[model samples]
Target: MSGAVTSVFGIEPGDHAYLRYAGDDERRLLRAAHVTAAAGRGERAVFVDAGAWGGHDPRALPGGGQVFVLTPGEAGFAGGRLDVPRLMRVLDAQADEAARLGLRGLRVCVDLDEVLAVTPETAPRGDGGGPGRCPLAVLRGRSRPPAVICHGDRARLPEAILPALAERHPLTLDAATALTRHPLLCVRPVRDPAGLCLEGEIDDSNLGLLARALETAPLDGRDLRLYVRRLRFADVGAVRLLAHAADAMPDGHRLVLHAPGPVIKAVLRHYGWDRRLVLEEGDRG
Candidate 1:
């Protein structure tokens, strides 16, 4: 990871950003980074994850910021269905608590997939139809509302309501995409495909870092795939390094490259490195 601090998606207070992660590990990684960044900025962070189902304890960081986790029951889910208004009020109260705690700002990261799995398809009566009554209304309070990041895993999302889900958010983004340029590369573990996610650019500067990460990556006899849909650039040296990594895999367990961009594809083809790694057209998720 780069030492440079940067926004993963340019998310700001009062902005409701939608994120689609490749798997649970990726979601957890991003969630931790988001919460830590918020705390570093002296903002109270509220995170909603599956672990909260087992009752997560609130944590206080050294930066004078605290984290609160909302449990499943606390989220206003009665009889396996979500109470949107109740959840909204709970979030508002959390923000008020943050204010009282002397936190400068608020940040909330919700595992939307886990919470919405039990949510009803139809909207609750008068929940979102009127002014200041919508579930997201809590995010646009009179004072500063918390910066909100809602995460979903497409594999776990209900196909019946996926379209409606996307329609609700204005700025939807893939978790693989990198919003900053300085990092040059960001690697995340993916569980569904049992591989690694490569974001941003990969060149001579970070080729060694990539090599080291690959060396430490788990390869349990299955082919390791690299998700590179958001990889912006890759030099010939990087291609060569990947080729070597693929060559080193156990027999019948090739390194798979998912959604390589035109630049990487062209480089692989030009140098005949594509023969070393299995190339897939799209992300499995």
Candidate 2:
């Protein structure tokens, strides 16, 4: 891994960005940006070339740090069958090794266009399985999460999967402008009683992001109060996730939904979900 820091896809350490490039020039520019950002942060970088290498030289990258390259076949993958778990394990091990080597951190880049071409329609869920299984869901909220950039050829990637992929990432990069922005879904942790403050829309596409956030919340067996007053809308999937969280609460503990909007409340009532979870009307706790 190289210890060079430069900015690519407008991404920094502790952030994840998705980049959709148009051509080889754009791809190389973004790759250089990633290497530059990692080098500037004094971190090593790992580039996973999912078949887009095309004789590119890693040494030619601007970063002075070590750059580790992993081709698709060398990463224990063949065709559409993706061993996501094994891939994650390898990345985790690499991060540990980087830390041991006294590097500040690690940056990871994946060629999404190539990965998707070989990613089976029914890929292994690999720990993120449930009602809505997201294969790359495990990449979120790691203990020492590296700056991840999933690059793709916009014209070649499937349109249907774009929203799903974007929701899994907190930040996105516009290849044309190299700008980054966050999606609507936001999960903020409340400290006192250890609850969640959710805002924005929640539906099938991003429901797992909410579930992942709830799973990691520091409820500590206490009543889990969800402040969703700022939430604009939610679908049946969001309701299901909330109900699951409510059911997991211990005896004497409750799952409370504070200040849910009229539409949300009506949906909960219509499906009799209000009976399963507590619904508070106003600011009163």
Candidate 3:
């Protein structure tokens, strides 16, 4: 149980893992994983909820670990806006309480679905500026708890803000796809190159997810590049999907794949799709 949380969620103690969930089902899965992991590690778990828990009450977890559900109002929200600083204070206090109770560590899952609904322009930021700039950054620096900053209901949060928020954390996982202990595939939007960054494996199980990513990606008439250097394995079905997406693009607009593996290239070449999809052998760096 020493590395229970890390083994399950790929999140180490005192590290912040960002989760972008599509809906409540994914959120529930992640929440359940966190609860089980924290209990295994004998750590007190605090769920800071802002309408993401669906009105679930806090209860005692297994192995003598306790769970606390915190609301925005309980964290001291003065005005109409959700004060991020106050939220940090609340989280710190919870950590202190966990320590006083002789718990091994603290684990927090913050559901920011309601928070993002109100502030859709950008992610919530704190007052101070520096290494520990944003509220979540400060939380990471202080408590060092294995924190899951859940950006729930992906439709509510703007895609433009995902990159900036993701950069602040060590790991960014999509709840819709990252169901296992270790992530199978991670699809993230690239801003400058105007493409999608695909990491990990893409198989039949996650082919539909990849299709949705390509369809929803910001697509202009220009080339829709896919940064696949970190993508280790992609099955034939996934390769075919990419080729079809590239073929569907407007004239002179193709899907550029950077550092595609042998499997992808062989599949495309065998199916006569290598011509339609632009494959770059060299690294994009």
Top model by TM-score, which number? Answer: 3
Enumerate clash totals for all models, in the order shown: 0, 17, 1
Worst 10 residues of 2 by lDDT: 1-10
Best by lDDT: 1
Off by over 4 Å in 1: 1-9, 52-65, 79-85, 117-134, 178-285
lDDT of 3 at 32: 82
Q: 1-285, model 1: which lDDT tens digit per residue? A: 112223443455666766777765676667666755554334567776655322334553344447777765686744435576777788778877876876656677776666543233542112333212225435665465677777777777766655555566655777666333354689988775477888866656788889988987755358877888876555557778899999998778888888876556655775677899888986442
Deviation from truth (RMSD, Å), model 3: 16.2
lDDT of each: 0.64, 0.63, 0.63
Global fold similarity of model 3 (TM-score): 0.51
True-structure RMSD, every candidate? 15.9, 15.7, 16.2
> Model 3 off-target regions past 4 Å?
1-8, 52-56, 59-65, 76-85, 116-121, 128-134, 143-148, 182-285
Candidate 2 lDDT by residue in tens digits, 172-255? 556766622124578888866568888765655687799898877767356777888766545556776788788887788788
Superior by lDDT: candidate 1 or candidate 2? 1
TM-scores, all candidates, are 0.50, 0.50, 0.51
- lDDT, model 1: 0.64
